[model samples]
Target: MMRYTLNKMLLRLQNRYNYDVRYQQDLLQTDLAAFLKFMAFQSMSSHQGNLAAAPLYAARLRAIIFEDCGPCTQLVVNMALEAGVSAAMLRAIIEHDLHQLPEDIALVVQFTELVLAHQPQADLLREKIMALWGSKGLMAIGFAISSYRVYPALKYALGYGKTCSRIQLNDASLVPNRAAVVAAEAQNVE
Candidate 1:
């Protein structure tokens, strides 16, 4: 009975988001306890902790994009849209149009990239984040960047991850800029 209920809930989420949750379904079928624990991580990923929709989604989309360019990235994009992030801003992020992004979003993107790259330069941006949104804001960004990567990693580990695909925002079909990711990785290697 619990399994049936959970399956229904997963179906609802898949339908609502137009996303593939097959990895989650596999987890549920193979290990109910792990499934529950995995699902519980949503709370950690979603603790906004006083973040406004823009900066919060900025961090989320950036982090997810770094980790995935396929369905998982699309999922975050859709959620960000539902959360009221402007399509233009989202387009800027995905397209890597740094010049076009709004100030706060640009800051979050820079910070997210630095942190993900494990670069000490993030410290300066961290200070900027603290000045703008305080520790709660910093915590929210931290959770978003760290937790959003888990879904794609789990999907790949379970053999359910897909290759990069075009991301759609409203009527616009945008390709994620892999150059930034490649550049970040190159920096890590240096």
Candidate 2:
């Protein structure tokens, strides 16, 4: 979709302008295993949702995390801190959820749980992110990382990252409650 082409352009801009990185370098850095992990996250997209909506939701999540995380160098780390999810725990959760993606195709039943839990209130969230990342120049970083999430989802949809095993999803819903994986993992992924 042409919308996606714009998304690609946006990502390039974030890296080039914000991270001082070249597009090709970002592409090369993606490990097959990590890429697979992101794909699983994508699979959590709407099980009963329109194909388009799932990506939109994923984009929003990326936006929140990236903005919260400081986008350029410490994007992943700060998102984990603000959302209270840890990198290692996030790795484990992604591993779990990707392995058992929703059975159907329309709406991403599983990931809704995650989306709901992680979506932060703008009023409540901005300060913490600012304190950790600074208020000035924190623009569009969320858009960049949210966009980044698509990459892994694409990979997982294609099916990669098998060797990078972890617990995998279960009877549990993928909701983003305060006690949810993201919050609890905030303590640590260990």
Candidate 3:
């Protein structure tokens, strides 16, 4: 068995995906602000001081591993403020405790954990994935999520990311009683 360092593994992932994500060069751009915000938030949320920042990078690391991680991926999810991953998802993986997730979504959640945890006996991830889902299934599992916890939230949050406007409105009539407009019409008829 080979002991794979995180960077070494990431390099392997980069080779597979055909692009290098140079840390400072790739992740420090203005466009990646959303992702950085997400990472900083995750780090704070985890209360781990620094390790919480793990999720922020985990998402991008996933894109590096797979060819087609979504645009919202981690960066968009964070920008949109919908990156709140469900605890249930994590619990489910622990419950199933299987080598691979039968559902495509389950696989990503589990594998993402595996990658993040830097678990050894690593290649076993591919083997179990293959057993559960053939080549096509693996692609489906790697590329999708069971929840839109982030995507839709990203849309609405980003919409409100800037200026806030308020509408001044008269009180809405909840009752069936007509307004003064109705009384004026009745007087005209008389």
Candidate 4:
């Protein structure tokens, strides 16, 4: 009965987001204990605390693009739009046009990039974030960047992850900049 309810809920999620949740379903079938644990983790990933929607979603979208350039990325974009982030700002983040974004949002984007790239330079940006949004807001950004990547990681581990592709937002199909990935890879090799 619990499995049936969980399956129904997953279907509702898929229909609502137009996303693939086969990997989640696989978890449900293969391991009920793990599936329950995964659902608990979702609460952390959805935490925004005191951070406003724009910066929170900004961190999420940027972090997601690093791990996933396909449907999962699109899902975050859709969620951001629904959370009321401006379309233009979303475009700037996707295009890596940090100059055009408002200073706070650009800070979040740059911070997320640095953290994901494992660069210590994010410390200064983290300080700025704390000053603007308080420590809880800073924690919100931390959870946003860290937890959102788990979805794509799980999908890929389950063989449901797809190759990178253009993400559709409104009428425009935008591709996230690959330069960050390249730079991260280059750093990893050194």
Ranking by lDDT: 4, 1, 3, 2
Stretch of 10 with least lDDT, candidate 1: 181-190
The lDDT values for all models are: 0.84, 0.34, 0.35, 0.86
List model 2 lDDT by residue over 56-87, tens digit each.
33334433332222222133323333445444
Per-prediction tally of clashes: 0, 26, 1, 0
For candidate 4, the clash count comes to 0
Candidate 3 total steric clashes = 1
Pairwise lDDT winner, candidates 1 and 3: 1
Using TM-score as the yardstick, the better of models 3 and 4 is: 4
Q: Highest lDDT, which number?
A: 4
Model 4 stretches with alpha carbons more than 4 Å out: 181-190
Candidate 3, pairs of clashing residues:
80-154
Model 3 RMSD in Å is: 22.3
- Models ranked on TM-score: 1, 4, 2, 3
Model 1 ranges with Cα > 4 A deviation: 181-190
Worst 10 residues of 4 by lDDT: 181-190
TM-score of each: 0.93, 0.27, 0.25, 0.93
The reply for model 2, stretches above 4 Å from the true place, is 1-118, 135-137, 140-144, 161-179, 183-190
